[model samples]
Every structure is written in C-alpha cells, then in structure tokens.
Target chain A: MSEMREATFLILTALADEVRHGYGIVQEVSALSEGRVALLPGTLYAALDRLAAQGLVERDREEVVEGRLRRYYRLAEHGRTALAAESARLRQLSTAADARLRTLRPRSV
Target chain B: MRRLLFFYPRAYRRDRGPEILETLQEYAGTSRTRLAVNLIRHGLRTRLGRPASRTVVVWAALFTVACGLFAAAFGSWVGWQTIRPLHESEAAQVAAELLPTQNLKVDTDEPPAKFVIYGQPLGWYSVRDLLLGDGGEYGQSGVGAGSNGPADHPERDLATLRENLRRGGWEFREYVRPDYGHEVYAGRGDQQLDITFYEYNYGASYISLGMDRPAPALATVGGVLGFLAGAVGGFLLFGWASRRTRSVFVKLLLGFGLFFWWAPIVLAFPQMVEHHLSEWHYSWHPLWEWLGQPALSLPFLLGTGLLVLALAISALARAQVRRADDPVPG
Candidate 1:
C-alpha cells in the first residue's frame, strides 16, 4: 500500500476509537491535528464517502439531534489494519528524524 | 446551505443532503463563503460518483470542452444573424467609384443568404452536397468584382482608390506588398473589403475586390458567455448520466459519440490555427467552419444522436437505491 496522506491518516485515527457523525469526525480531526487541519463539512463528507467506498469505513448508525439527521460512521476491520501499518511507518520515520536532529548543532537563535 | 446542495446530483442530494446540511449547520460560525465554496466544489465532485475512477473525470472534461466549443459556434452564428447583407448593387457602385478608369466586371451578385453552396442559397437541394464530399463548397456568401485588362496607370489608380476608400469612411486595416502586387484590407463598420492587385510579367494585370461583413462584437462576447454556460451544463449533465448508469453499452455509446464529435475539431483546429497565422485576416472564418461543420455535419449529427441515446438510457435506468438497513434516507 502507498503511504497514507496526513488527512486520511488523521481521519482514520479519529474514527479508531468510537463511531462518530460527520461533524464529530471534523471536530476530532481538528482536535487531533492541534487545529492545524480544520476539516470543513464538505471535505469531511467527501473523505467519508471515499473511505466508505474503499471499505475502510462503514455507516454505523443515525441520530436526530436538534432537528437534524446525523449519520454516524465507524472504522472497519481493513481501516484498523491500515491505520496500524501507517502508524508504524510514521513512528519509524520520526525515530530516524530524532536521531538526525541529535547529531546536528543547536541553532543560536 | 440548501442552495449549495443544488450543486450535487439529484439522487445524491436526496440521499445525503440532510446529513450534509446538519454538518454545515454545526459549523455555522465558520466563513460562510468558504463553506459555500467547499460545498459547491465537493458537491460537483460527488455528482460524478465513482471516486476510484480517474478516467471518468477526464471524459467529463472532454465532453464539457466539446459542448463549450459547439455552443460558442452556435452563439456566434446567432450574432451573425444581426448583420445586414451588403447588396450587389451597392458593391458594384463602390467598385465603380474605386476604379472609375477601369472597366471592372462584377462577377458575383451575391444573394442575401448567410451560407451558400455553389453560389446558390443553402436549401434542401444543397443538403446532399453539404453532407457529402462537396461540403467544402458550402461557404459564406459575398460580392466580388474583377478587372481583366491592365490599368492605364496602375500606381495612379492605386493611389486614387486608397484616397477614395478613405474619403468613403473605410478604415484601412492592413496593406501588404507581395512580390506579385499589392493586397489591401479595409473595413467600414461591420463590413470589410479586400482588394488584390496581381501584376503579370507580360503586362496583363488583374485586380480583384471582394466585400463581406466581419463578425460583430456581439458574436465575440456572446460566444464567450455561451462557452462558459455550455461547460457548466455539459459537466453537470455528464456527471448525472455517469452516476445514473453503469451500463457498459452506454459507456461504449458515449465513447463513440466523443470520437465522432471531437475528431473533426481535433483535426481541424490545428489547421485552422495555421491558416489564421499564415495570413492577415480582417475577420476570422466563422467558428463552425473551424469545427469542420457542414462538411462533417453528418458525423457530428451521428455523434449527437449517440450522446442523446446514451443520456436517454441513463435517464431511464434506475438509480442505485440505498440498502434498507442503511440509515440515510433515499
């Protein structure tokens, strides 16, 4: 498999724990990325549709909250495995980067 | 938010619109413009469905561009209809005034027809010729006059002609002195005139003049607007049809339609560009001519038929229904 995009990885990570609706996923992704990645409703839905089509996510359930329909989504078996692999790959890269940083002289600034 | 949902396909809007609205509502504090733009962009993408298939986007783009070109041509044609044809008598009078000394013969007294085949108005009789190998014979009608004998004083006549044209309110656009002789282009309002002086080594010089109208500014502006409208409409239609049908036969029909419609344009466009670059055109050949129309009208019609058939089939086909267990309403 190819290396996962930051947004996709974050989305999968967000859904790894509990089933969430569209807005829930957006909030979780933003929180996880330290507000660096603010997933809009449209962007979130597109990504959700793509993930669902790939069988990496599945529709979980629906709720009526404040007179609005909220369709929830959950990570699938394939998504869990893919997320694990991506996490390991990221960890390896981060470890190598940390080692390189330790060898470099500190900036005066 | 509701208006933004309009960008999505009908079936997609039905299935997912409420959920998307709910999500958007939750982020109401966010930039409405950014949110609206996002909805529109993704909504259009959603209309095409098949997120995994990259080729669908390419096909949609091609179909959109073809529709844009065709619409621009049609719009230009509509704009051309506003022009009043220059009468043969008027042309002859102008010719007489320009070359008073020379006994010029008016070879063509053009009929008031937008298009002609073999010097006659386009009609049922010309249909066969228009569709057949003689399609190139179909062309815009114009008045022309030529002189057979050599001018008594070629240089003096040329000078007098230029002065007469200027005094007659004709604006000189281009003047070229070739090895053979001189070619002058002048225009008055929408109408343009081309004068050529061909010098023979044996002293038998021939001078010819032709008058026609250039495409009005309306055509240029209308064509641009039409192109934009056609692009949007074509893409939306293509997306709707693409999502509604998974039939291989429909895809095949679409493929054939694209080939039939786009082949002529692909083949003719480069040649037309070369032609335009090769000469100083007072006005370009009409847009349809560049698309190889009339000559290739049969193939174009066939392509249109195929595309319409494909669209009809897609329209009749049942949209994919969401599973009953799925929470989203159809």
Candidate 2:
C-alpha cells in the first residue's frame, strides 16, 4: 500500500464518522487540521476522484439544491483501515521525536 | 467561472461537469485561477486516461499519414496522365502517324519495345507493361525521367507538325502553355497524338497515338455506373462506421475508405455532373486537367479529408459528452 497523502488522510479522517458532501468535507478537513490545511475544491475533488478509484471513498448520494448538485462522499471500510494505519505510523514517529526532545532540554531548567 | 469548465475534454465535462460546476460556483473565488488550472490538467488527464483514448489517438494519426501518402501517389499518377494527350484524339492520331517506331540511334544494340498507336512510331520503356502487369522490373530507364526527349521533336518543327495535321484534316486539341515544354495535341478521324519536345535532349520528343475515343453515350453511361458504385461503397462504409467506431481495426478501415474513395468521389463527381448537365467539354479544358493527376489530386483530397475528419471527430467527441451516462467509455 502507498502512504496516504496529508490532505487525503485528513479528508478520510473527516469522513471517518459520517458521510459529507464536497463543501462539508472541505470544512471538516480544515477544522480537523486546525486551519493549517485548507482543502481547495480542485485539490479536494482531484484527490476524491483518485481515492474513489482506489476504493477508499465512494460517492454516497447526490442531491440538487438551488439548482446546484451536491455530491456526498463516505469513507469505506478499506479507507478506515488505511487511515488507522497512517495515524498509528504518525503517532509512533511523534512519540520518538518527543522522547528525543526531552533529552535536549536545558539542564538548568 | 463555468466557462473555465470548457478547458476539460467534452466527455470529462459531461460525466462530472454538473458536480464540478456546482463546486466551483460555491468555493472558487480567490483561488479561481488555481482551480481552473487544476481542472484543466485533470480534464486532459481523463481524456487520455484510458487505453481506448490512446487507441483513438493512434488510429487518427495513422489515418492522417495515410492520407498524405495517398495524395502523393494520386498526384504523380494524375500528373503523368495530364502530360499525355490521352483525351485529345487528334493528338493521338498525329502520334499514330509516326507509329511502328521512330528514328533512333539504336544505341547499345538494344531495341525499344516498338508499337503502333494509330500508325505513330511510339517508343516507350518495355517495362511499362511489366509495371502495369504483375511484373515489377524497374531496371529499365524511365520515360521522361531524365528529360531525354529533344529540345523539341527532332523530325519536325512545331509549325510543320501543326500544318501537317491541319492539312490532314486534324484539329489542334492541346498545346503546352506559353513558355512551357513543347507539348501539343491533335486529332483527326478518331485518332489523336500527344507530342512533347524536350529541348536539351535533342532527337527525341515523347509521342503517343491512340484511338480510345468511345461514343459519348458510352462515356456518360460509364460515369453514371461508376458514380452509382461509389455511392454504394460510401453507404456501406458509413454503415460500418456507424456499427462500432472504437475498434482500432475499424478505424483503420474507415480511414482508408475516407481518403481513398472520398478523394475520387469529390474529384470525379463534380466533373461528371457538369458534363451531363451542360453536355460541354469540361474535361477538355487544360486548367482542369492537372487536377486529375494523382500526385496533386491525392494530397489535395487527403489534406481536405483530414480537415473534415478532424472536424467530424471533434463533433463526435462533443456529442459523446452530452449523454449524461458513462463519460469515458471506449
């Protein structure tokens, strides 16, 4: 399996709980990353297309409101498993870095 | 902003166009350029994203090249025919007047294939028959290949030839255009001769005589029959194309039919129509003669056909997008 991209990871994480439409995913991903990562519609859709092709996320449904289509996407079981693996990988790396930082602290402190 | 969607291939736009437009409408304000660029890139990606798309592209390219080759071949053939006054009976007769073989130095103890066309001494490479037949021998020197004919026909002056033909009741049918090579045509009593005098290569001017003038009724009937056959062929080809266009093999056949038959149809039909309508000598005119040459005609037709094929593909591609079903089907 390939490593999950940051935006893709966040997007999958956003949909881990429930289904979300394009705008909803963008909003949730932004909030999940604390505004550090904003998902542009173009990048978001491109990744969504790729992820869908990989069977990671699927279109849940589509609805037309105010003459505009809103397509919803949901994380599949495969996507959830992939996300769990990626999160664990990040946690392990962060834990090692934190332990190393502890040693570099000022001795006087 | 929606217009930016046009940058995508038609099929891509069709499949996800509505969804994409809705997204761009709501979110693409400050970053519209980036969004547009990304969409354009993805659109192009999807257009050639599949094996089917690649196949279509390859076939189209092959067809384009085939069109060029067909043009070159047809042009040279037509040019060769034009240089000979085959259509001008009087000219063939003047040539026939010299038949059974012309005066030659008889160099190298090699005798040219001597034949009589309306009694003219017409000498051409023996291999001409072989080339026309199953034989593929190309070792012999080509006719008019190196401009071996005299600066003019050696036996007679242009004036003397013309007067001789006229006195023999032959009428001037064709001549080299001003300052062009000394080519002339004349005919009398169902016989025609075409003469070309090469200035540098003295003592030989290519000459041919023939009695190929069929009755006007026969010619018209032949043209009509040929047109009918062509129409049937065209209809059959169109039917084949309509059946399935995605197959590479089918596309190749379509390409061949379009360039090969399409050219002759475009070229010969108009002349036929005019000939039957006005009952005039439309073909006899010198201006229209070169158009029949294969070298010129083939390329002209193929180039035009390519343009037409491109337009047709573009139209078909656009139409493919409007179905609102699967966008990227083979």
Candidate 1 per-residue lDDT, tens place, B185-272, comes to 8877777888888887886568888888888888787788879988889987998898788899999999999999998887788899
Error of 2 at B324 (Å): 31
TM-score of chain B of each: 0.79, 0.32
- The superposed Cα distance between candidate 1 and the true structure at residue B12, in angstroms, equals 5.8
Task: Report the C-alpha displacement of residue B3, candidate 2, in angstroms.
Answer: 3.0
Question: DockQ score for model 1, please?
Answer: 0.55
Clash totals, every prediction: 0, 39
| TM-score for chain A, candidates 1 onward in order | 0.92, 0.92
Q: What is the interface RMSD of each candidate, in Å?
A: 1.7, 4.2
In order, the Cα lDDT scores of the candidates are: 0.84, 0.53
